[model samples]
Target: MRQLFGNRAFVLLMVSDFMQNIGIWIRNMALLFFIMEKSNHDPVAVSLLTVIEYVPIFVISMIGGVLADRWRPKRTMIWGDVLSFLSILLILFVVLAGYWQAVFAVTLVSAVVSQFSQPSSMKIIKRCLPDEHVPAATALSQTLMSLFIILGPMVGTTIYQTFGLLASLISLLVLFAASAIVLTFLPSSVDQAPDTTESAGSLLKDMKAGFSYIASSRLLKVLLVVYVVLALGSGLVQPLDIFVITERLQLDMSSVQWFTALEGLGMLIGGLIAAVIAGKVKGTYLLFAGLSFLGLSTFVEVLSQWPMLTGTMRFLTGVLMAMAQTVLMAVMMQQVDEKFIGRLGGVMMPVFTGMMLIGSGFTGWYMSATSIVVVYFTAGALFLLSSFISMKLPISREPVQEEAEAPVSVNATVKV
Candidate 1:
């Protein structure tokens, strides 16, 4: 752990993530409640916020990879944060002018910018760290995410309720600005190869190759299917999450933060546990157990009438999901070609987000027609399907050692 933190580039990236994740949570809760108030807690309006959030990602994921590949990773990340800061600033003003509907734009802009910054982060982790450090890096990243998951809603709600939307927006702006500044301290790009925009056809060609590569690789193909199914499941439940509080628990809408915070708390502890057992566990088993039980947990969560039971299930889901993700990263690191890893992320992200977008789009209407419980029940079923499919994946415990691998060309590394 000491040695891992000793790497300056890694540290800077973590700091940037911390700041940005904090900002995201603040925006998520603050904007969420603000919109709920303006729209009278309409499910469609909230779901629309989700749909808008994913549109840019589904549109940009493949294209962002090409850009991330062409641009310096460090520069790409910094610019992504900067653009996010500026966009949030613009929306903050628009909100102040009484165009409260523009609040959804905040989620949309942040999600779009993240499509770039996120891929760049993966590239940086791949480049700066040695193979041995990957697990530790994964643990540290997930831990940070878990911490924020536990804290973001509470903090975002406190700020939003106490100081109002303006203050929350300002908080977001400052946090993003801080994150951008932190990223600026990251080391210069180690791979400063020239940009790969040779011609319009080159990008299309590379994208074609990326898809072809995934299709040819059975492991990658199975992973994509698992991801797409899980994404759709999660998305179906996400837009209706607040109702678990409003209708189920019979609590105020703002009380939904507690619901999420419990899940985050579970993840926080789960991160620690997963880190401990990561080396001892087979990555594939962890993936299967996590998703399988995660589905069961979600299935159980909506069925319970007690708030404590609901929170417990949420916490369990958090732990399982975090563990699942930690090992899933291991599986990817073990399975995917290193050169192709960046492209793999570029490819997988859009596919997952696209499916999530599909599920999220109709979930609002579905919930209106039925109830929140049915929506989550269906989501759980999808996850179970994903889990069953994941069982077909070939097992391997080795991590990819990039140094020993053969190289692919700049044209192939076309995405950021």
Candidate 2:
């Protein structure tokens, strides 16, 4: 762990990632409540925020992957931060002008630009860290994310409640500026050779190759299916979170922060746990067990009206999610070739986002027609179903070292 942190390039990249994630969450929390208030808690409008945030990922993730492969990872990441900083400025101006609707538009634009950052960041990590340190790097990254999740909402909600929209926007602006500055220190040397062979037709072929790669691996295909299903279930229930706090629990907007904070705390602990058991435990076991625990926790939350119980359930859900996601990310980092990292992320974006879109859309309409509880119950069932299906995958108890030494490349023949 200390060795990973000692590397200057890795440190700078993590700093940039931390700042960007914090800024994004802070902005999201403020904007979400604002929309809730302006729309008078309308489910469709509130749900649109999730849709707009993900639509770009669905539309441009593939293109972003190709660009990440072709471009310098550091340069791509820095440009993404620059674009995000500019978007924050636009949001500030929109808020100052009292053009509330424009905030959502700006958020959508920012999401589109932000797609380039993740793939590029992953590419950079692959370059900077030795194969042995990849798991540590991933765990540390997840830990940072958990920290932001813990702090962002509490801080954002406080500022929004005490200061105003303008203050929240300014806070985001400062964070983005810091992120851009931090990212500038990242090494400019090329990490991998650019794909000079790419032509007009090459993009489509590259994309098809990514899909084929996934189709050929039973383990990859099953994981993808399970994750997509999980996203669908999540989309159905996530947007209803605000309603659950406010309407179901009879609490105020501020109370939602407690739920978020506890969840983040759980994630932080989960990350630490993943770090300890990284090489020893099979990712397959963690993935399935975590999903099962998370699903059961979600069901518990739906059944409870007590705030303390609900908060505990949310926290447990976070821990399990972090455990599952950390392992999932580590496995991907270990198994995939550096060249296809971006494209794999691109392929994943649409699957996750598309499922989320469906979940959000269905929840929005279904809740309007029925109730939140029904959606919760249905989503829980899906989670259990995903866990059950995962049992059939070819995941083994073998250490990630085995896979790291034998990476599956973009052009590898599909395994029957």
TM-score of each: 0.80, 0.81
Q: Please give, for residues 1-416, the per-residue lDDT of candidate 1 as tens digits.
A: 77778999898888889888888888888878987999999999988986787687668778777666566778888898899898888888888798887767666777877877776787788778776666667876888888976677779899999999889889888988898898878877644544456433376766665666676667777888899999999889887788777777788898887878888888888787887776677667777888998889878877777888888888888888888888777666656654455567788877877788789888999988997878888999998898889888875544323332223232444323
CA lDDT for candidate 2: 0.78
Best by lDDT: 2
Q: After superposition, how far is residue 222 of candidate 2 from its true place, in Å?
A: 1.4
Q: Across residues 193-282, which tens digit of lDDT does each residue of candidate 2 receive? A: 465553334566667766666666667777788879889998999889998888778899888877888888999998887776766776
Q: Candidate 2: minimum summed lDDT over ten consecutive residues — where?
A: 407-416
What pairs collide in candidate 1? 65-415, 65-416, 66-414, 66-415, 68-416, 69-415, 69-416
Q: Model 2 — TM-score against the truth?
A: 0.81
What value of lDDT does candidate 1 attain over all alpha carbons? 0.77
